[model samples]
Target: MPRRDSPGPESWETLFTGISHLVTPAPGPQRGPAMRELTVVEDAALLVQGGLVAWVGPRRDAPRTPSTRDLGGVAVVPGLVDPHTHAVWAGDRLADFEARLAGVPYEEMLARGGGIRSTVRATAAAPMEELVQLARPRLEALARSGATTVEVKSGYGLDFEAEVRMLRAVRELQSLLSVTLLPTLLIHVPPETGRAAYVQAVCAELIPQVAGEGLAVAVDVFCEREAFTVGETRAILSAARGHDLGVKLHADQFHALGGVELACDLGALSVDHLEASGPAQIVALAASETVATVLPGVTLHLGLPAAPARALIDAGACVAVGTDLNPGSSPLFNAGLALALAVRLNGLTPAEALTAGTVNAAAALGLRDRGALAAGQRADFLALHSPDWRDLVYTLGASPVRDVFVGGERISL
Candidate 1:
C-alpha cells in the first residue's frame, strides 16, 4: 500500500488547484454524442482527503487542506477506465498478424489453430509467476497512458487450471500496482477436443471454484460463429449469474448473431465488440442497461470496420471504449491512444470518447466510486500536457498523460 510517487503530502490529503479545464461528465441514464454535455469548469480546485474527492469547485471557494499541489494550468480529466482487456498471457502472435494481413480471414485462422488457440497453448504452458511477470509491463504501460482502472480477462487460459493461473496472476497484479484491475473469467473458446465436456467443466466446476475463491468479479464469453453459439453463451452466463458473478459478453465482433439480444435479456454489465452491429442492435442496446463497449483498438489492429460508436451514442445507449489488449487481436496497451482511435476511427467526438472511456467505462466494470471527479468519488484524475482535453483525442498514437493520481496517490506517468 505504498504510494506510487505521492500526489501530495504524506497523509494522502491534499488540495489540487490551477486546472485550466475540468471535464466532469454528468451522471445519467444513457451516453452518446449529444449526451457529451459534460460540465466544464475553468480554473477549478479539488480537495482530496483519504484518497477521495472531498470537495471540488472554484479555487476561491476551496477549503484549506494540509497540503496542496498546483497543476500549473494543465487540463485534468477523469482517469481512463478500460473496460475490456486480455492482459494475462504469454506468447507472440506476430505470425497470425502477418497471416491476417495476407488476406486470411480471422475465423479461418482460428480454425487452422493460429489464433487464440495458439496463444492459449503458450499461456497454458506458463507458470503463475511467469504469467504475472509478463503482464506487469502491459498494465504499467496502460497506467502510464492514463488508465486508473482496467478490466483484465482470463481467456487465454482455456482450461480450469490455466484459467486459475491467469486469474491468480491478475489478483496478484492488483496488489502490486496502484491501478485497479478487475478480473474476468472468459472461457474464451471451446477446447479443440470435446467442446461439450469442456463447457460442462467450466460451468459446473470452474465457476464454483472461481467464485468460491473470489478470484473474478465477472464472467465473459466470446459469442461468435467461430466461438460459442448463442445457446452456449446463454448457458454459461446463466451459470455465472447463479454464482452471483457479473456477466459480460464478447458479442458480434465479426458476424451478426443474437449475442446482443441475449446479453440484454440477461442484463449483462457490458456487451463488447459490436463491429457487425446494425441498426436493430443499436436500438436494442439503447433500451438496456448493458454498456455498449466498443474497442477501436481491435478494429484498427485487425483492419476491420469500426464499431457503431456514433449511432450507439446518439441512440441513448451507454457507450464505452476499451483497449482490447491481447496477443493475437488488439495488443496495444495505450488507452489514451485507443481514445484517439475512438474519435478518429469510431466517429466519437472528443467529449463523447472521453465520457465513454471514463464514467461509462466504470459503469461497465461495476465500479460506482471511481469514474468522475466529484465529491465522494475516488480522486482518480490524470493530467494532460495540453490545455484542452480534446487534445487527448486529436493527438493520435501519443501519450499526453503527464501525471496520474489514483485514490489521491500520484503514480509516475
Candidate 2:
C-alpha cells in the first residue's frame, strides 16, 4: 500500500485476485432506475484506485496493476448493509431477557413501564461522551463482522434534548469507524405527553431542528396497536416527509394496523418488523419501491412468529434484513447470524437472504451508490474464508469472514 498527497486516478494501484467466488451484485426483478443488477465473476479480480473500484472481471481478464494482494481461494462479497438498528443507548436488559424466557409476555412488560421505557430512562441518564464510548465498540464489532454500512436510530431518547444527544453520538461514530452509518431520528411513540402536544413537538419542533442541522437522513415512527395509531402514524410520517427526510415505519410488529399499507402509500424508504403483515401488504410492497425489511431476530428473541420473508420475495417484493437491535425485543447484533436465522427460520433462500443484507438493505437506507461491487460503486466489500458463497448462511452459527473492507481499505482489528 502507498500513500499520496492527493490520491487520484494516477495513484490507482493494487489488485485483489484469486477469489474463489464473487457475488458482485444481487439481482432483483426488472432492475429499476433506483436499483442495479450486481454481477458476480467466477475466479474474479478487482482493481482499486484512490479507494474506488477501477475494474472487476474474471481473474484471467484482470487489468494489470502496479501492486496487488492475492487472497487465495476466498469468497468475496459486498460488505453487508444493515439498514435498521437501535444500537445507540445505555444499560443492558439481560434481566428482561430472563423475565421474558420465564413466560412474561412483552405487552405486559411494556404496560408496566419496562421495555422501551426502561431504555429511554437509561439513555437519558447517560452523558453524551459516555454514550459515544459505549456505542463505538458495538459499531466496530459490526465492522469486524463484515457490515460496512448500518443505520442507527434515536428512539431511546424520546425527547428533543435526549434524542439529539443520541444523534450526535451516532455522528461521532461515523468519523471514528470504517462503517458508514445512516442516522434516523426514531420518534418512538411519544412519551406520557398528550398525543396533540407530542405531535406538535415532533412536527413543529424536533423534525425541523433535526433537518435544519442535517443531523438525520430519515425519520421513523413506531406504528403498532400498542404504539401510535394509524392516524397518529400518518401525522408524524407526513410531517417528516414535509421536511424532505425519507420515511421509515416500524409497522406490523405486534399487530397489523395498516402500517404496511400506510408505508407503501407514503413511499417510505422501508417498513420494518412485519411479524403480522399479510398477503395484501406483501403485494402492495411488491408493487411499490418501499423495501420490506424483516426482523427475524426480534421474533426469535421475543418467542413470536417470524415474518413471512419467503412470501414477500416470491411476490417480487424487494426484501431487506436487519437486526432491530434494541433492549427489550432483539439484543442480537451480528448481521451474519441474522442472515442465517433469516434463511432457516424466516423461510428465505440463501441468495435472497444475501440480497436482503446487501443491496436491498442499502436501498432501505436511501443510499443509491453503495451495496454492490460495480465499477462506479464504492469499493466496500468483504473477504470470507469459505470456498462457497452459500456456506456463509448454510452454516448458520459459523463465522467464516477473514477480512472486511470499506472504501478499499481493510478494517483494522
Give me the candidate number with maximum TM-score. Answer: 1
Deviation in Å, model 1, residue 108 alpha carbon: 5.9
Clashes of each: 1, 1
Q: Write the per-residue lDDT of candidate 2 for residues 1-413, one digit (tens) a residue.
A: 11122334646567998798888564232222222244558899988876777888899998877788888888998888888889899987776777787888777877876777888999999989999898887777676667889999998887789999999999988877757889999978676758788877888899999999999999999998767888888888888889999999999987888999999999999999999988888888889989899998887887678898778877878888998877678877688778888987788777777778888898898876777777777888889988687776776555767788777777775
lDDT of 1: 0.87
Error of 2 at 173 (Å): 1.1
What TM-score does prediction 2 earn? 0.93
How many residue pairs clash in model 1? 1
Cα displacement (angstroms), candidate 1, residue 298, comes to 1.4
The reply for model 2, stretches above 4 Å from the true place, is: 1-10, 26-38, 107-113
Which pairs of residues have clashing backbones in candidate 2? 25-38
Question: What C-alpha lDDT do the candidate models reach, one value each?
Answer: 0.87, 0.81
Kindly report which residue pairs in candidate 1 clash with one another. 32-313
